[model samples]
Target chain A: MNIIESITKSDKNISDYKSNLQKISLDKLRVNPIPSSKNEIWRQTNKSKFYRFLDFKFNNDFYYPQIPGNTKNHNICRIIIGENKKIKFKEKKWEIKELEEKEIYNFLEQKIIQSDTTQNWSNLLNHFLTDRKNIIGLNISGKEIPSLEIICNSMTNFLNSKTLLVNIEEETSVSISQINIGDKNSALSISTYFNIGKESVVNHGIISFGNNKSHIINTLNVRQHKNSEYILGSLQYEYDFARLEININQVEGNAKTNIKGIQITKNNEQISTYANISFNGPNGFLDQLNKSLANDKSHSVFEGLIIVPQIAQKTDASQLSRNLLLSNYAKIDTKPQLEIVADDVKCMHGATISQLNEDEVFYMRSRGLTLEEASKLQLRSYYQEIISFLPISKERWDLLALLLKDK
Target chain B: MERKKEIKQPLLEIRDLFASTENLTILKGVNIKINPGEIHAIMGRNGCGKSTLSKIIAGHPSYEITSGQIELCGKDIEPLEPEERAQSGIFLGFQYPIEIPGVSNLEFLRVATNARRKFQKKEELDTFEFEELVKEKLDIVKMDSAFLSRSINQGFSGGEKKRNEILQMALLEPKIAILDETDSGLDIDALRIVASGIKKIANKNSGIILITHYQRLLDEIKPDFVHVMADGKIIKTGDSNLALELEKNGYDWTDEFINKK
Candidate 1:
């Protein structure tokens, strides 16, 4: 079926849900008409190749995700194309269930209809394309869950999209991990929205391990309430083409946000991270650290923007991007930007691109380590800061370390 | 054992060595021979090529050996790389040990020890044995067990860094140990402790070369021979009293002595 016809038919067939999935995409398409590579947001990233996958048939029938047998989580969400199945082994403090059609419609009408249209065009496009596909809603209230692992997997030539809405109640704490695994020629997109309640704590990690021929895109939109805290740790490795756009808003005063991300790309892989955090209330704080390693002919791009308005007095935000270029042909483009209209704010941004330290290599060599061993040691250290900050336990770090060693 | 080591052969010998860096000569036709069971103290003023000599022996890549021969255990080792030289039993205690951020001290020690063991064709020590060995060596420097998990010398104080260098010396047990200004920037207590550690590690199978400007370190561990270096060459060689003379009268006598020569 054609892209427009398929989406229009799905919109009609939906039972009682006024799915804005196609409306937003159609509206944006009517306004912008076509995706433009000249746009500032897409300047370093090319989306022309994704147009072909855009018209691919959206299939809702596929095999269940093959998660590792040892993967354990109190709440697990598995998505394949448009189908979703959630298995909850324990549900003491929170409820995990499929979002009703009426609930999904009310959410879109209440949240997206009144938002500024020109701000997040890409996110609107993402939502329009993925809203009616598959969704899982989490209602957490004053409980601490060990971890929730969401596995997204697809085979070759498949098209899939999934969404998650996490409504964290006051004073609740939760940890969530999103792992994306895909085969060649798969096109996967995910959108996760977090409504963090007052005085709540949320720790999230996203590990995207896409194959060499797949295209994956993920968008995270988080709105934090007063005195709430959100920490996000992410790593992306071996993606043919991937983009992660994270938009965080401190809707109330005294909120805290921390983000740590590591991206390792080799060969022809291209990975990009765009994070924009806005402090709307007074005393909102943000700390972001993004480290990327690009080897061979790979390309890594990072753009972090922190906006503190005039009302956000006493805001403290720091954003830093540290990138490593291992080979002569590897490329890294990083921009850490700050827009502070508040006079009483402390804001700092820095970007660094460096190769391995020669002196460090010599020092290790003098201690009898070979050149390769010394290089590996530096790489391991480069990721230690991010890995240590991850909400995962210490015993699980060895698994991540072993995965990094393979690269 | 001492007499046998002394009569057998010199542990390290520099024969008419000439080395330079960036087209500027540093060590000009220098000759020095150090035998096992001997402690040779090389005292020199600033820019006298004392550190250069130690680095050249360690095969630092910045310097060029225009004409020189470094023999370790009666074999020419000038052609080997720095790591090869290290595995061949040459260790240089840097005046400033580099701070390797991110690598823990324990992991660094284990990796270095394993590399040396692999080079020697000896069976590698597993984690348990290596941890025990590192714990034993940590006491030699009076270092706490907490330091094993920290990054290597990332935030260590001057005395602590020196002790870590000595700890590596104890772990590697090189045949020719060149302490290049290892006593610099150390407190009195740290100096005594470091000197004592060096004495404990020095044995009949290894030769120690103490490179320092102050005679205070020698007060703790007396050297059998003292050499005064000036203008890229060793000018005067004497007993331990030479260090006291230089400490009392300064290096002016060496200039006059070189002028007369």
Candidate 2:
């Protein structure tokens, strides 16, 4: 049987509210089956690897996640989403409360379903596969909210699905770090939604990785109000097959959005990222940079789209994609698309794919560094451009060191 | 006749050197010997193989030595890699230093200094110790302490880049230092500063080679021997007067000399 049929057959009894939403999502998937290689959306995707990802059975039993021992930090509020859901801190400036069923239904119908249901296939797929208990929705508020961290892990030999929804009140400011880990032979699907209120600021980071032969499909949808600022830094590596999709909408314009993301692939892995951003009103701004490094016969792909309608006059947007091909067999594909209907808007997009500079490598070698050491130094330099923009602290995670350890 | 005292070993010796890139030969039948405590200046027009000779000595991979022998203190060093040649005390000061972003200058210097120290059987310095040593050496180029924390040569002015190169030379303390057109882009003050730094780093146990096209730099740092090169070979060797003569009359004089040979 197909993945959708299998998921539908395994559906269990739940509240009428959640079951209704799942039914709608299932109908959508049934109408639009998996896209073939001829489809523009899945043209670069490896068909065999995608089929393998969909072959896993849906996991119904709750499996406890393996949390690393070294992930404790007193300065931030931590939340773990797994078999044992837990929240670690309480502060007076901010609060978190679960979303009611009526609230979830209202959000889906208004924001997601009405926006463009056809384009959000990944979110619909997640909604259809995810159990009612696996969804985590929180309403957060306050001006001085503490930094937040969310840790999500997948179980082995199963297709685990989870969803997160966060609603921020007006004038609230928060920094969030989301970490996702995939276990061996596992498949994970995650859908996240964020609503930024007027005059609010959001700093978000997503760091995800997987073990041997693991797969992940992550989708993020964000809505921003006027005068709001949203900055996102994302990184994905070490997954056998991974896809990240991002959708951002400036609701009333006059908002600022900045995104910096990187994907690293090695050893036959395939990773891809697709980002679509729209400026709905006037004076909206966006600066996006996407980078990928492919090594050891791996493949990396990036597709970015920016839309500026007639109402979004005076909008400013720029998108840049930089790729590094580290081996002769490694492959990188990048496409930047801009659709600007506004006559007075300034929009620019560019893409570049290149190898390391030989002159730079030889310069270091003449300074007493071995060839391997020189290459590693150059790689470190390349990784720093994106790493320095991350909100995490080096003393806490030391991501640069982690990236260079194997090299 | 009284027996002649044994001659001291030359610090660097190049004999019958012939080198080329993929389709063109750049250096042809060149010979030079540099002794301890002596400074040699090679003056030539553009593309006369001055910089190519310096790069060949440092083991640049672009050029192949068709028939040549490079000896360091009487030991053949033609087979050593660039880093090994550096660890064996050969330094090349580039005319245009590359700008490397995101790599700390101090960290690079520490690693390079320690690499040479390890080859010389000396214990490597930790971060703290290396910082102290580097600060002491910074005075040789009169560079500010702020540049140490920045990326190597990224956004540095031309003079600052040259000074940084000299600071590296001081830290590495190579036996044979080849400064290739170090005064090309410098103003009078920067040239004076760079020349002073080079003079300070020169010692009795080390030799210096300056490749240039003008006599202004030679005025600051005097050379014991000045060699005029044309068509990939040294056509004339004389005292410091040759540099003054070339400065007065352009490279046109070298054509007559080459034709006579």
Candidate 3:
């Protein structure tokens, strides 16, 4: 059966509130066809690869999520999605509680129904496929919160779906690391939402990778209030097909958003990122940098958009997309765009695609480094800019070593 | 009784070297020879193929050798890759050292030093040992330790970059060191420090080639032979007096000398 048919026919034991939303999403998916290359957003996407993502059977069997090894020593508050139905952590400084039904309903009404209109396909698909057991919603509040690590995994030959919602209270500061791992020939669909309260700080990192020929579609939505700050660093690699969609809104302006993300693609893998940020009030600020590295016959894509309306008079935003084409056959598509109706706003966008500098390689080679060593050094240098921005500790995960191992 | 004569093989030798790039001849029938303990200064005008010759010796891939032979310690190195040539004891300090962002200068130095050591079959130094060794070499250039922590040449000034080049030379200790325009961007104080560093690094088992246009550098680091190159060929060979004459007359004198040849 097709993916949509299978999801609709599956036994979905969820609350009435989520069931109603799922029915709406299922009807929407039934009417509208799957997006193809003719669509502007999916223009660079390979349709057959995406069809393959939808070809897997819905996984019903229980499987344990394999947590990364190094998280044990860090005293981090860990949550493994698909392993638990309800999670709660309370400490002296902060508390994490599963969101009540009313809170989820309010989130759907306020954020999802309002801002996410045109590009709601991924969210709709995720909502349709994710049952109550697969959804994790948390309301986090405190001044000195412990670091949080959330992990999501897909089983082999199965299509898994998961959703996460986090609401940070006012004056709270928190750091969260989200890791998504896909098994061989598996597919995963994930939807993540963050609501930052007034005067709060959120440092979030998303590190996602997959085994051979795995696929993933991830969507992230964030809403920031006044005097709040939201910083996101993401890295994705080693998937046959993976796409990340990020939507951030500065609700009342006077907030800060900093995003740095990179996607590395090798062999026949394809990875893409689409980020959109909008300012609703004045004095909103955004600094976004997206990078991609493509090797072998792989493809990488990046598209970033920043919007400043008339009310956002003092909004300042900059978006840059930098890409590295590591092989002659490799390909990269990058576009950084800005839409500003505010007369007094400052907005800039730029994109660059280049190969490793030959002169730099020759310089290293002249210093007794072999060509392979020199290229690896260059790759390490290229990956360092984004890797260093990640919120995770280097000791906890040797990201650079992992990135350079195959190269 | 006739005394026994001692003979030494040349550390570097280039015979009838003809090289080109993209159908343009850069080095045409060029030749130079250097023995141990000798410092050869090649002075020429801009675009006289001075830098081209240095790049060719370092085995830059852009240039194709139509015909020639480059020997390191009497062994032909023409077929070696750039790294292979470097491993075989040849070092070429760049004219404008490439700046690599996000690469630590200390780590780059350590890797390069270890590569040379591995080629020489010497034990590789661990991080602590390498740091100690690098600290000693940093003193030669009078550089601060902070530069080591930064990206390779990334925010370094011109003089610092040149000193970094020299620091690399000091660490690698190649048999033949070809420094191209190492004095171009240095102030007088930096020049004194760098020239003295070169002098310290020079030993009886190695040869140095200083490519420059100024007689000022030649003043600080005396050369055994001064060659004037014009149109890809060394037209005149003399001692320190030749540099003084070049300084006095500029490269205009070399035009007449070339005509005489």
Candidate 4:
């Protein structure tokens, strides 16, 4: 399939992008063979379970799932399912557009397509499978914009991918949330790239829920400029198999990055999370916290790495991974890696794996709480640290509460 | 020379209690009776099993009562669970309160209060009414309203944690309150406030059993009887003057007296 010809035939607004995408579509066709368990990065996640679904063709005749009513908040809500996309605004103050123009094409081509998108198989597949009209662009400046929400659903047997490019202009702040809910027997992937301008702030949240027999993958790449701040809070709760990879690069001095994530898996499910943060300038800062809970023979993996180069002096970075194994048969793999080439950087990492505390349970029980009530309280508090970082709307909270369901 | 006369219908009674943990005996044939409107301070040295007695009474799962009977209001509560014992008007103010990272103090108190109320077949308070009730009890410990919003004792100092214990005691209003070493980590000012808080909650229908290592707390809150426990058994029982005598003479006198016997 020629990607450029496919995109050009779908929409006229992106006719100019067809030629540019033509230059990269040939490179996207060179698929990296599916990684095997022998590979170090693929050791924790068994890739054999996903190989049979790799060559699936797009299912265009399936029903486009409707966006549920609970997701319609006071903010700007956009629903994207297959080729049908709709955007509604309650109070419009920000810019929302499609990335079919010249400037966005240049940025996406240079910074994303020609870069390490070649190395990631999911990125390569996304580049080949996704239409250019499926890309959404958001820009916020000089205003307090409400949270922009995107609800994505995949009813196809093959990959249903969407890309979001968000830019926060100098000294502005904005929040974005992307939710993926897919049907069983479908495979989906979503990628988001953030361009944080100087002294601006951006808060991004991604939540993915999949039914049994579903496979999903999500990727986030961020570039932060001088004095900018970026926070990524995510909850990946349900799936038969899922993986989330986040890469953050500090482009200049004094940029900050905060990442918080929670992953819950049960019933033979498997979930993996990878977070890599690099400091390229001096006085950069990063704080990353990730937690996972696995039960009933399930498996959960968390890998966090922070890199500080010599030019990035006085970088402050800390990463901690806390995991809980509910059943004796459950498995959790956590490793926090810190590679520091700078002489003056302050970086530390720690990982802890523990069960529900006996003393804490007894304490609650001594206070008249039954065993079930006590355990429920402890479990709720376990995720409160990350849940509190989510957006404050009732709808968002309800979505966050899904993390604790059936625990 | 004589112990105070026992009131009718004792609140808590332990008859010939013998308990141990993991085959190591801690309490050897301990016996005591506490009645309403009275404060009994059990004074002992380290390893004399004062805390073991408190834990056994509270039904801590770690300890096994080899042979004993623990009765509340003349009914055997030996087979009840810890929460069951608690809902039956027995409160154990922990010597070291555990810090729960995410459970708010307010929510814990509300759950505990409702659990007891439900056990007693009473109506549970709604959120607004429960908040009002908790606010009134907050004054008993002189605590700031901000502490209620925080995780239970997550970052509390030693004194603040002790005050929180007292605040919970005030909220539950248990018929029998057993405070184990509530005076250990307190300064004099905190000691005064905590002692007064205990006093404020103590009433004619409720009894208090205070376990302490010092007579200084006895100076603030006088106990009706001071029992000297050595090697897990009460060797001497006397009036309040026995606490002063023990503070002046120390446990050496008890060892000498036991050696002579």
Q: What TM-score against the true fold does each predicted structure earn?
A: 0.92, 0.95, 0.96, 0.90
lDDT (Cα, tens digit) per residue for candidate 2, span A1-407: 34755544533532332566767676666656465567555789987788888888877456666653345664777776655454334468777666777888777655445533456778888887777777777777775777787777777888888888888778888888888888998888899999999999999998886889889989999999999999999989889999999999998999999999999999999999999999999999999999999999999999899999999999999999999999999999999999989999899999999998888887888889899888888889888888877777786688888889866
Q: Per-residue alpha-carbon lDDT of model 3 for B9-73, expressed as tens digits? A: 99999999999999999897899999888889999999999999999999999998899898999
Q: lDDT (0-100) at residue A184 of candidate 1?
A: 74
Deviating ranges (above 4 Å) for candidate 1: A1-20, A47-60, A72-83, A86-91, A110-119, A131-133, A393-399, B1-5, B253-261
What pairs collide in candidate 2? none
Question: Which 10 consecutive residues of model 1 chain A have the lowest summed lDDT?
Answer: A73-82
Interface RMSD of 2: 0.8
Residue range B1-261, candidate 2, lDDT tens digits: 112223589999999899999969999889999988888999999988999999999999999999989899998888999999999999999999988888889888998999989888999999999999999989888999999999999999999999999999999999999999999999999999999999999987888899999999999998989998888888889999999999988898777876787
TM-score of chain A of 1: 0.88
C-alpha displacement of B242 in model 2, angstroms? 1.3
Ten-residue segment with the worst summed lDDT in candidate 4 chain A? A1-10
* Candidate 2, position A30, lDDT: 60
Q: Write out fnat for all predictions, comma-separated.
A: 0.75, 0.69, 0.86, 0.80
Stretches off by above 4 angstroms in model 4 are: A1-31, A52-63, A66-69, A81-83, A86-93, A101-119, A138-142, A156-159, B1-6, B256-261
List model 1 lDDT by residue over B1-261, tens digit each.
Answer: 132344768889999999999999999889999988889999999999999999899888999899979899999988888888998889989999999889888899899988888877988898899999989988888889888888999999999999999999998988989999999999999998899899889898789999999999999988989999998999989999999999999998778877787
CAPRI verdict on model 4?
medium
- lDDT (Cα, tens digit) per residue for candidate 4, span A101-121: 675677666754665433365
For model 3, state the Cα shift of residue A337 in Å: 0.5
Better of 3 and 4 by lDDT: 3
